[model samples]
Target chain A: MPRTALILFAHGARDPEWAEPMRRVCAAVREQAPELRVELAFLESIKPDLRACVESLIAECWERILVVPMFIARGGHLKRDVPLLLEELRQRHPQTCFELAPAIGEAEPIVQAMARHALALASR
Target chain B: MPRTALILFAHGARDPEWAEPMRRVCAAVREQAPELRVELAFLESIKPDLRACVESLIAECWERILVVPMFIARGGHLKRDVPLLLEELRQRHPQTCFELAPAIGEAEPIVQAMARHALALASR
Candidate 1:
């Protein structure tokens, strides 16, 4: 059976510490969806860019890949750059199909998670 | 004379890279609220815990302090530990007044940020 892969994309940081939560989030997603193949990639300040991630997914023969951005806001990178890159990749690799989902920030689960964090703060 | 302070809190990591975004967000908040005193504090894997942050605010003689959690989820620390700590601090420092707002994750700006990231990915 063809695999469905989830690529958790983060805004890469040179600091190195910034990546842990993103990794943790990817881990949580895997825990929730054990059968799905989940991976982590970054936009800047690190290796394994989106194209590299996509190529690896293609090698794995994932029929459908969901790229979820682990970003807080769509300022410059998301609004302009990411799409341009994805489009170029799609044109280059016609054999591989890709589906890009909204950043994880837009997901309701994330919002709920934030709310839970808030409530925890308030009760304190 | 009195002032209002914004405390940006994160679940700090030993990795060091995780803290950059929190610092960036705090910087952004400072840029937006230039007059306000914005500070960064961590929950674990670091020094200057939440209580220390609050104490600093008190030392600065701020009349009102806002504690904003930088966490994405309300799992363990935010949900249980933070509130317990805050309560202990409040009991100790009756003179200081604190307003614990929801985590930054719950804010609409964060969601918008995530969406923007997703849009960037799609356009790529």
Candidate 2:
């Protein structure tokens, strides 16, 4: 069976702490799926841009790669930059299967979770 | 008791559909807290900027307001822009208490939900 990897893609910031939540999510996924390799990549102001991260994974012999955008919404970055970068990677490595998941915010449980958190915070 | 309101604050996009997820989250919050007034506010490219949303809520006699940053991480926008905006709002409405919650991504449950979704997608 070919190895599979997961990349939590996020919008980086100048603040080093900006990536903490993404790292936490990546850690959680890593804990849940020990068999699958999980990593985090950023769009800017951070190390290991999407291309570099994917290239590293490809070098590691990951045949199947899933990119989960850590963004809260399907903004221009998701609609334009992500596809453009992915297409380039696809052309570079046609044999690898790369799948893009919906923005994390678009997921029902994620949305509901935010709602619950908001309620709890407001109540407090 | 003074009225309470929740504002789901987000970074808006030029694409109308980009706000769908934020709307879903606002809907979920509204459903979960029927008694509390809930509204959606955007940083740009959408209606009801944070100031306007908070101003409207204040006009409605909501003395207690919670601004939930729907952003995924603590970027410059969250760390700098949000605080500046909130401080201005606070100065404008001295009686109202404007509480700013941590970025939704910083919430543990939200992070976990993203991790779960990522695992499910990677497995699929």
Q: Report the Cα interface RMSD of each model, rounded to 1 decimal.
A: 9.1, 0.9
For model 1, the local distance difference test gives 0.65
Identify the runs in model 2 with alpha carbons over 4 angstroms from their true place.
none
DockQ of 1: 0.08
**Residue A89 Cα positional deviation in candidate 2, in Å, after optimal superposition:** 1.9
* lDDT (10s digit) by residue, model 2, range B1-124: 5567989899898899999998998888889889878899999999989998888888888889988898888778887888998898889889998888888898898888888888888877
Tens digits of per-residue lDDT, candidate 1, B44-91, equal: 876678888888788878876668877543445666688888888778
State which candidate has the highest lDDT. 2
Best model per DockQ:
2
Best by TM-score: 2
Work out candidate 1's RMSD over C-alphas. 10.0
Predicted chain B of candidate 1, TM-score versus the true chain B: 0.87
